[model samples]
Target: MKLFNWPNIRLVLMFSLVVFLFSFTSNRNSQRKVAKSTVIFVGNIDPFINQETVNKLLIENNQDPQSIGKDKLDLNKLEKSLNGHEMIEKSDVFVSIDGILKAVVKQKTPIARVFNNGHSFYIDYEGNTMPLSDNFTARVPLVSGEINKKNKEDLADLFRIIYDDAFLKKNIIGAQIMPNGSLLMFNRNFNYQIDFGRIMNLEHKFKNYKAFFQKAVLDSSLYKYKIIDLRFSQQVVCTK
Candidate 1:
């Protein structure tokens, strides 16, 4: 029994040494190869953030793959740099087994663009304010006139509801903020305004609007009204 155990232990040690040597040699060869270029994958281009812009950013910072080697590349640092950009919502950088460096970036999506007192910016989906991009302008709902940064979070909630509904999203094109902090929405196809007062009882207001809208459409009176007020409690008032 002692003789058999000694032979088995010797064979196991020899196999482990062979595996370690092979792994070490393969790792050394990988480190010797330098990254030639970066492969970028953008999930949503949205005209704001593009592949060229990301590549240019890396080049400007001297972090481009052309200057990076597998042995010296810091994936965590690269990812952190990309995430620091306001437009980039998230980013991932990784070096493949074939010595290729790849980066996947996702840009933020804005639901509304605001313009007030010559200042312009965007409200992202998460209710965060982002500066307007010089590269491209998103075709989202434009909010102009008296702007209140304090109620932006509430406004973002309203925008989310309108943007989510396919019917409302297609119909509303812009909005105006009244001095009383109420919202006035403009229709794209019709020459009418929706007086969407403060952010209260949103579900009830939207439901009333839908019911009234369906009734108006059935009666062929959609274009006849000039103003639809949904500020009341479970009631829709139209002015012609």
Candidate 2:
């Protein structure tokens, strides 16, 4: 076993050179200024915030993303700021090797827009309320009248239920919570109103409606009723 063989010496020298180059590259990259910022909005839904807005947010603390050096960039802190935004559901910030400050942002998906007391806001899929965006409006269900904590929770349940069921999602466009605590749904294609009664036994009520809709479609009688009631356990009460 040779202590200082040519192969061993060569290997050590090579390792040293590699480390030196890595250190040099790292040092160079650390000082590299971010050229610009690119925002990527995840998901198929329309973005609530635009690229300009995102770039502005990246520098909201008066730190310019384009001029800020990589070493000076606080990615974690920046991400926290982004996540704290009311419209943002999740966010990730990182600088690319080429000096591009890239941000991946996902906005809260609104399931319904609530209107009450002359105020309007959005209710997301996570049951969180978000302010309406000026950039885009989601074509989700419109929930008007008698909005409260309990009512919002029930509406969230209905939203999830509708979203899960394609038929309900496509047909039911909006809902109304009456002052008497009864819930009503508006059909997209029909002029009649649906009386859901209460939030209890939601699965049963929807099932009954589905059965009635199928029968009505078969008979071409859906338009004959002014009100479709699903309050009872076993039947659809229709008013013509």
Q: Tell me model 2's lDDT, rounded to 2 decimals.
A: 0.88
Q: Per-residue lDDT for 10 in model 1?
A: 94
Best by TM-score: 2
- Residue 176 accuracy (lDDT) in model 1: 92
**What TM-score does model 1 achieve against the real structure?**
0.88
**What TM-score would every model get versus the actual structure?**
0.88, 0.93
Instruction: For candidate 1, give the lDDT of residue 114.
Output: 92
Q: After superposition, how far is residue 61 of candidate 1 from its true place, in Å?
A: 5.8
Model 1: per-residue lDDT, tens digit, 1-240?
Answer: 576698899998999999999999888865655555464556557768767767665552565666655777767877887788889888887777777667788888788899999999988888888788888888789998765677877888887887788987887789998888888989888787999898777778878887888788887798888999999985799999
Candidate 1: where are CA atoms >4 Å away?
Answer: 3-10, 34-43, 59-63
| Candidate 2 Cα errors over 4 Å, as ranges | none
| Model 2 residue 57 distance off true place after TM-score fit, in angstroms | 0.4
Worst 10 residues of 1 by lDDT: 32-41
Per-residue lDDT of 1-240 in model 2, one digit per residue for the tens? Answer: 998999999999999999999999999999999888899999645878788877777894696878878999999988988898889999999999999989999988888888988999998888899999998988888988977777777778878888778999899999888888888889999889999998889888999999889889888798889999999998889999
